[model samples]
Target: MTCGLFQILMISFFHLIELSSQQETRFVYETFRGQENLYLDGSATVLPSGLLQLTNALHHQMAHVFYKESIGLSSSRQLSFSTHFVCALVPQPGVEGGHGMAFVVSPSMDFSHAESTRYLGIFNVSKNGSPSSHVLAVELDTIWNPDFEDIDHNHVGIDVNSPLSVGIASASYYSDIKGKNESINLLSGNPLQVWVDYEGNMLNVSMAPCEVQKPSRPLLSQHINLSDIFPNRRLFVGFSAATGTAISYHYILSWSFSTSRGSLQRLDISRLPEVPHPRSEHKNLSPLFIVLLGFLAIMGFCTLTGMYFFRRSKYAEVTEAWEEEFGAHRFSYKSLYKATKGLTRMDFLEEEVLEKSTEEISFQTEK
Candidate 1:
């Protein structure tokens, strides 16, 4: 009798699971603007222009932004999701390439265990390739990493838990007119629209420049069972960016996600926030440089003031042309000062008389 009851309960649970899988969740961010629905960490922030700026031109740093709430069907263990977003990867000044960014679906928001690196905040060297990670990342990588077995320096990859990609392709799109694969520069600083769709066991990633619409063919595609990856069928979606020795700025102008096929919200490219130029109106001077500049200014001011006072206090005797012409017959103030500096006038007169007498005696001897 107990076994019969257990069988009935199991059947009812299966029926509930079937019903739960039909629930759809949608999140669209046309512009962050004044919205506070995202949880940001590290160097992530929303620009005043309603853009999501991830990492700045800082090296060895990482930043991330996630939806404030977890996204998943509460009663289902399988989810078919699609996401669309417009993003920009601007190269730092004079930098050719850089570490990259990723669109990640993680089980939890706590990534302290995985230190940021070439992994793009997905996993560390130790945690990578471990099934326990339960992370899915669509990487838009710029820097070539041999450790991760990257295909090239500029490419898009589908990473499950490790930086190593299961499906990879150059950063480009298929042209219907050309009937071939054409390459695109990922670090061109231009906005690009990306679509990630996962239905059944197939995952597709497609992208094109903002000017170009979605291509008929995907840039890269692969078949992977997401249900097995997400043990609990729950996920959190976000953007993760990392920098190495090189620097780059990652940005997201808009993003939308949906569980229904072909129903992902489209971004308003015309109204999207612009990616600020690589060089701002003013340069960013470091704190140390500012302090040194201030110190130098203070020292220069002190030196100038000291010199001005010294010149003012020193004595200067000015002699006119008339004084110079008749100085032999006239007693100038300088002559008076010399005669009166130490000896009295009477003593000076006596010296002059002795000199005259000596001259007279010499003249008589000569005669």
Candidate 2:
């Protein structure tokens, strides 16, 4: 009886350990296949290339796509997420790029008031400095806004409940496999990877080119308490982007998120899928190029229409002026034919000669 009791106690302890492991294993992952579980708003769409595009050739457009199901982010627990993506911003030659794109965890996924261009489709002019808007976003900004006091035209910004950045870093990546640092242009139209982890009171953001391994040192590390910022435990995770007169093509190749309060290893890295080959920047035409082509076509059509109306108006003016001078009684073809005996001047002259010759011949015969 003593041996049996000891064996039952051991079984119960092992069962409790198994339950704890299962509870911390929740994960959310997606490769954006056919816009499966995503909610698209505005210009967002799944392209034929299998990339999830947030915005297309439109100007003054704001677009975003969020997970249909809300992510259960706990204010008390730690969370880690890694996104593997590629973005191509083809701005007009002399003009600026877009406001930017951001990975956001917000109280709600609605962005109806977000403005285009410098606002990044995450917030509008009214919400820029507002305190009530609760949000945490990692922005890949390609343009500089004087209102936000951006450090440069190209940088990555980490924001808490505001469009103003708490921290900013010029976009760069490690060059060598041995972790030698190199600063490359962020908007060079290459693929990049960004990792965000929140553990304890620290938030770390690391970024690198897709070719290099993940960097050991984070570009930006700051201390903040998530519980204070986000009183609401539940949040929505997704992406947002916008364009003013400028434009860009924002894409999400793959993404994975884990809600585990345990080690980062517990979060499955294998769930993150591989991205497709980087698209050729030269092969893909600029959104401005397409816009210019459309504009020229419309202008050509308008010019032709104006010319047709102008000619029609000028002809009408001449006819009206002539009618005003002469009392509206116009010569008809039938009246003219009767007045000249249906004969031209040459025909009338020949007929007159024939009649005179016949009369002369009759006179000679009588003589």
Candidate 3:
């Protein structure tokens, strides 16, 4: 009986180890445009097994939405997943635009049922607004709307409970493709990088312009207890994009995810080239530049001080020469008293008496 119990205990320990090994840290799914549902060329590529690339100029209504469902995560385990996508607007002038793209996590892995134009194409029409069903979408919206032009051209939003019943939780107007109510300046498509972090009951979304020096701060943050969305813990992760009439391509470059046990580690930003600044023409110095600026400022201060003293000295020399030529001229106290004689109180009283006498004499003369 002791030996049998020991064997069972060993088996149970091995089983637990196997379960722990199954949890996934990083998962990348890339689908190109054109080739067999994958949209754009050179935008999406699958390097070996784990690595996936989503590049520019890719679009397809029916592309292979690559997904990794069992990221080795159990219901009890908590995870933080982030997706990095490199999407560029296809340079088409007059094409009617479509919905942009989304990072979605739901109970279903079926991509066919997830189809909607403006609404993230991932809703069960059967359970349209039902909270019992599983649905969550983080949308990167590119299209414009009359109601919410308050939001930016490229903005991030979250849709929970159902896809049909959606709301723009967060959004920011980005400078890339510019347009007014009628027409917009279609500059070269600007690349957008977005980050979404979900920890415990908190969900935070942040984005940086591709050329920005620093990663963008969180644009919108909403804290909903995970229990509100899903009673069960594990969720399948995938991406969806749709081009309704006018074809706009979307691409996912690379993605990484991590769980509580540290299953998937994200690549450090130090490993990648620093994101270029949007205004590269302005040669603004970093903190190191402040030191040189301080030196220059000190030099400027010294030069200004020297110039002021030199001008003051020159003025003093000129004044001395003028004083010598003028033979130290002075105003005497007697001259000052004579100049102010009309201002004395006695002068005022005498003037008043004279004015009265003059008035009387003038009256007699007139009579």
CA lDDT of every candidate: 0.84, 0.69, 0.53
Model 1 misplacement above 4 A: 1-22, 73-77, 280-367
After TM-score superposition, the amount by which residue 324's alpha carbon in candidate 2 deviates from its true location, in angstroms, is: 64
CA error at residue 339 for candidate 3, angstroms: 99
Listed in order, each prediction's TM-score against the native is 0.71, 0.62, 0.52
| Ten contiguous residues with the weakest lDDT in model 2 | 261-270
Residues 311-354 of candidate 1 have per-residue lDDT tens digits of: 65542356688868787564644457666784655787999999
Higher-TM-score candidate of 1 and 2: 1
lDDT: which candidate is best?
Answer: 1
Sort the candidates on TM-score, descending order: 1, 2, 3
Which lDDT value does model 2 have at 115? 76
Clashes by residue pair, model 1: none
Q: Is candidate 2 or candidate 3 better by lDDT?
A: 2
The positional error of residue 32 in candidate 2, measured at the CA in angstroms, is: 1.5
- How well is each residue in 70-124 modelled by candidate 2, as lDDT tens digits? 6544433454444434444444433455767888878788888777788888877
